[model samples]
Target: MPDNERRTDQRLERAILELLDRRAASATICPSDAARAAYEGDDDGWRALMEPARRAARRLAAAGEVEITQAGRPIESAEARGPIRIRRTR
Candidate 1:
């Protein structure tokens, strides 16, 4: 990966935690929130970062810093598909 791609992954990881910090303890955030926070475009360009954002969340989940949920129930990141929400681990 290029330096820029590496940087984006790092940024996405931090952004994920930072974004979660701003939400209520019981609230959750979508991966797009981190993608948009790390994105520099005004258009839908952040859409391209979708998978990267998900990967970031998965990494965070593996570290036990965050919980990946589907339909309000915690699930393994590898099994997560479709829409998902992220909340800091308690």
Candidate 2:
């Protein structure tokens, strides 16, 4: 991957984790939260980071750092179809 893309990916991952760190251990966060945090601009450009944020969440899930859930139930990242939330693995 290009350096910029790699950096973005890393930033998204860190954003997801950092955001979680600020919440209660049992609390969860939406991917959009990380996307918005990762985005530096003061515009709707964060929308473009949505997919990247989801991908970052999936990567974090694979690394056993987080869980991806839909309807409050843990699901495989690949099986996450619609809206989902990220939470620290319990």
Candidate 3:
């Protein structure tokens, strides 16, 4: 990947982690509401924020930092849906 793309990816990862931390502290996040408030506060686009959030979630799952499961089966689709929760593995 290009240097700029790598930097953007890192930034997204960091942003996602920060958001997750905030959610953990608050116990929940209404995605639509939070995204709107963030955009109003910083002029960031919701799609920009969401793309990275999804990427970061996938990376976390691959690293075992978070587990992605759907119903009783492991998720096979990148677009799979269900409840996604984070847990500390260490």
Candidate 4:
């Protein structure tokens, strides 16, 4: 990946982990929360980061740093589709 894109990915990953750290251990977060936290200028531009945010979540999941779930059940990141939530691994 390009340097800038890589940096953005790293930022989103950090945002995901940090956001989870601030919440209750059982709490979950939408990918948009990380996108919003990583984004600057407070505009809808954060919307563009949605996919990247999801990818970051997947990466974190693969690293065993987080879990990705849908409908309150943990699922493999590669199999995740539609709405999903991120939470610290139990």
Which predicted model would earn the best lDDT?
A: 2
Per residue, candidate 4 scores C-alpha lDDT tens digits across 1-90 of: 899999999999999999999999999999999999999767799999999999999999999999999999999998997999999999
Worst 10 residues of 2 by lDDT: 73-82
Residues forming the 10-long window of minimal summed lDDT in candidate 1: 18-27
Residue 76, candidate 2: alpha-carbon lDDT: 97
TM-score, prediction 2: 0.99
What is the C-alpha local distance difference test score of each model? Answer: 0.94, 0.97, 0.50, 0.96
| Shift of residue 29 alpha carbon in model 4, Å | 0.4
Once fitted onto the true fold, the runs of candidate 3 whose alpha carbons sit more than 4 angstroms away are: 23-41, 69-90
lDDT of 1 by residue, 1-90 (tens): 999989999999999999988989888999999999999889999999999999999999999999999999999998987999999997
Q: What is the lDDT, from 0 to 100, of the residue 61 in candidate 2?
A: 99
Q: Assess candidate 1 and give its lDDT.
A: 0.94
Residue-by-residue lDDT tens digits, candidate 3, 10-88:
6655554555566554243323332343342456566555544555557766776554444434463375665543332
Clash pairs for candidate 4 = none
Candidate 3, residue 73: the lDDT equals 42
Between the candidate structures 1 and 3, which one is better when assessed by TM-score? 1
Query: What does the lDDT read for residue 70 in candidate 3?
Result: 48
Better of 1 and 4 by TM-score: 4
Global lDDT of model 4: 0.96
TM-scores of all candidate predictions against the true structure: 0.94, 0.99, 0.50, 0.97
Candidate 2 lDDT over residue span 1-90, tens digit each: 999999999999999999999999999999999999999999999999999999999999999999999999999999989999999999
